[model samples]
Target: MKKRSLLFGLMATLVLSFASSAVADTKRVLILQSYHAEYPWVTDVNQGIRDALEEERFTEGDNLTLTTFYMDTKRHTDDAWKQAKAREALALIKSLSPDVIVASDDNAQSLVVRYLKDTSWPVVFTGVNADPRDYGFLDSLEAPGHNVTGCLERERFQGSIRLLKRVIPDASRIAVISDNGPTSRPILRRIKTQATESNLNITGIKAASSFEEWKQFVREMQTRADALVVVTYHVVTNEKGEEVPPGEVLRWTLENNRLPEVGFWKWAVEDGLLLSEAISGFQQGYHAGTLAAFILDGQAPREFAVTTPQRGERCINLSRAEALGIAIPRDLQTVTTLFKTQRVVK
Candidate 1:
């Protein structure tokens, strides 16, 4: 009987120790994505998040648990439908109640702000371009007067322009395409300002309101412009009237029309763009993950300086370069962050 009592005590002690160890070894973090399926641009963002988490000394499995939720908007046809996805996403988020919620884009950020206005959970947004004041997410960018902050992908515009200038020197007439809705206006205005200051002759094309319209718009623009530039658009509707794949449209334009196109996301570079520049989505994700780790460590979101895409040039598709008969200058070559189709063997 004494031996059995000793065994019971030993077992209880071991169980308690194991439980304590388990609790200490696990950290839970929730990553909320605006889309479930992978698109090239944001996939890098997820990769960045993973890379950052992995580099951290205290990460999942060793003191962390990463829970990622990707909202799927492929079937939604309109903004209302997209918001419906947001609502559904909110329901899911309420259930998860994670330690942190990483908003992957403006859409996800909107949903989080609208749904969790009073919640104290930390939210780190990546790839958003909306004015914080407009969404009530913050008082201002200079001082994010709320519990939200991360990185924005908007500032990569200049890098894109510089690279395009390298690839298409004679590109005085550029064709700019965008969906005509909530987000496009600001992006267009910025691009327009840049074009005017840079002496870039740009012809802006608003994408069609419906999927059919978008298709026709692309067909029409094939012969109208020297090169193509895509900007954020929220007005173009999918069949479900909720969301349209802007990247896909950009891709189709490149593959079918055989023209040089440039995008802000490397994944959106497509095969035919003479050159493209974008902040690494994965890099953005890493910034977010690191910021999230800070919050997990009990630091306030506002304590960290709001970050933007690190300045760098990543280029792609030199095959597209050759096909377009555009000579890539050495100066631009010196700054390129990526080259998709060829190796710089020097």
Candidate 2:
């Protein structure tokens, strides 16, 4: 009886040791974001990722370890600086040796994933504006076939245009404006194609890299076009050759522009754009986080198909509409999310 009790105690100790080892086996994930933490869009994406991880019971610093690196590419637009930052990120990745890497937005994919492509490490990306094929990350959307897969932020140009038509029935001509950046170029191309395919007259498509140029283009469009479609102005440089904050550009437009403005991002509606059929940044990150979880569970990234946003939100700025004397349709009010206050000023 004594011998049997001693054996039972040894067995219990071994079992407890194994359980502790299993609990201590934490999986590490690295999230590489192209923009800063304070940027609203990036913040939403991060929130989505965190929420999804929480749903999976992957608590950070517990069963899972998460490390995030923000390149702040929006503020630092110089090519040389971007390259240096990419090198720094790569070094950090080497040190971390994370099990999975999540690259968010165009710059992160362009700088980090592009370098680590076809490697043993798996990469999941979100908020990629351009075709993954354009960056040689995949053979086709249907089959990534290797280690990278995530979601694409399809530009909602046609949908936003249709909504704009509903808001401004008599408006015949429109101008599409965006910063002349790598990410914006692909979006502009799609917008132009959609404009050509639709019935609405596209007065012009303007890409402005500098703040002074952006203001000039807006002023020109005010006379030449009935409405303006804002894409993104996050990377536009100011008159002093410094990167201009997106809020500053939106505020300038709100104070100066006479025509109704529409956009593809929800933040634009909050920032005083008249209306938008906006893509949810949070959804993009959530889907990407889901994919990351799959990878963490030993599923290959290639096995999960690349996905696009399943839904778009129709957002209206009521205060801006009232200020412009444009009456919102009763049906639109029922279906759309309305914002009364300007989220950004000056």
Candidate 3:
């Protein structure tokens, strides 16, 4: 009886050892999203990350654990609020002690990855519009030369401009309109450069932070510019000087604006813009997730190169085109995703 009892005890010890080993092998990933959870752009990017993680057989609560933090920076634009939220995010990161960190968008990169660069934990970032060099995150696109690597959200200005030209053959002078937000600044610069190269005269570049200012600029552009290229309106304030929702801004712009409109995001087309050559936010997150997976699997972030999205979607709003008395080529109709209403596809 003594011998049998000892044998059972040994088996139990071995089982516990194996269970502990399994737990130790599990990887923990923390995702830092710079926008609200309800934001479609944020949700789409999160979905892409989830899909990529699933592809690697990383199931949550089993062999992989995933945690997410949404900074809600889009709604709260004040410097003090942002600083406080940054501190909160940093504290959370310290407590979690994640194995890998995946940051999404410019705010995350600026707020979280900026402080944690070259640390023990690896970081992969996506949806950054500003040049990575601007933040000293990498030596070059080819090699990060640090413990950070991921995809850059290249401005789709040229493609969208080309599409706009195709649809509006007589459009000579164009005006670029965007809110005076951090994300739009880099993109607006790129658009100005591309506009000059494309030989399309830039009549005006209006960066407005309030509804009245945006309306005034749009009214001016309607009379002078042949077409309007809307970048983003997330930071625009309403009449009361309070922050307004992007959807409301788009709705107002669609109802009031007269010029043929084009933009870089697919959702813009659904939101009343006439055409777009959209960069996929989902693919950006997927690439970032791919980098995170590599780091979790024992590969250094420096081993992987920074990437730019290879695919773009041609999106057109047929109803908006018709409303503006513009004609879309038959070939474009055959190849592009056409929407008749303001309903956006996720």
Candidate 4:
């Protein structure tokens, strides 16, 4: 009986030790987004992260503990709110001490990761539209000498414009409009450069700060330009300086604007835009997630070079095409993804 009890005690001790060791060996990661989870970009990026992590055999609730934090700057773009959310993210980071942090978008890098540099923590950032050096994240794009490195977002401006011309066959003068936010500023510049290179005439460009301003801009552009290129309206605000919901912004724009609208995001086509050569949010997040996985497996962040993820879907909204009185060329149809009217503006 004594020997039996002793044997049982030994087995229990071994099991306890093994459990503790397993827990100690587990890797933890934290994904930080600048926007809410429901945002299509955020959702796509997160799915990419999950897929990459799984490819690397890091499954959450098994050998890895993954957590996510959303700053939600897209919904609440006030200056005070931005600071508060950054502080909130910082506090969470301090509490969790995750092995690696995956930050998505400009707000995450500019607001949160800016303060976390020169630390032991490895950070992988994705979907950064701004020049990364502007945030002081790296020594250089080619060789990031810090514990931070990841993916950059490249909008397929020329490709999308050429495709738009093919579909419309007469869209010479373009009017480009986006919100006057830090993230959109760089993209606006790039679009102008692309237009010049492609010899496409750009008649007007406006970055509206408020919904009223956006509406006015859209209305005026109808006469000034042949086609409308909608880049982003995430930070468009009300008179009270609060961000207008993105859905309202798009619906209002689509309902009122009758010109051919070209976008660079899948959500735009999914919403009601005429066409887009969309950047893949999934590729952005997947590359960042791959970097995070590598860092967790003892690879240094600096070893990876910063790069632009591959271009995503070339999409045409059939409903939008019908409304605009344009038929998608069958050859173009074969090359690009097609969407039915997801939302009826009328």
Q: Give the clash count for each candidate.
A: 19, 0, 0, 0
CA-lDDT, candidates in order: 0.67, 0.87, 0.86, 0.89
Q: What is the TM-score of each candidate against the true structure?
A: 0.82, 0.91, 0.93, 0.95
Kindly list the per-residue Cα lDDT of model 1 for residues 229-312, writing each as its tens digit: 866433467677655555465445555655577766565444335566765777778888888877877877777656676754
Model 2: what TM-score?
0.91
Which residues of candidate 1, in runs, are more than 4 Å off?
1-11, 181-183, 210-226, 232-252, 255-259, 329-346
Candidate order, TM-score descending:
4, 3, 2, 1
If ranked by lDDT, best first, what sequence of candidates would result? 4, 2, 3, 1
lDDT at residue 11 of model 3 (Cα atoms): 100
Cα lDDT tens digits for candidate 4, 28-54: 899999999888889999999999998
Off by more than 4 A, model 3: 1-7, 344-346
Candidate that scores best on TM-score: 4
Q: Candidate 3 at residue 317, lDDT?
A: 94
lDDT of model number 1: 0.67
Off by over 4 Å in 4: 240-242, 344-346
Better of 1 and 3 by TM-score: 3
Instruction: Give the number of the best model, judged by lDDT.
Output: 4
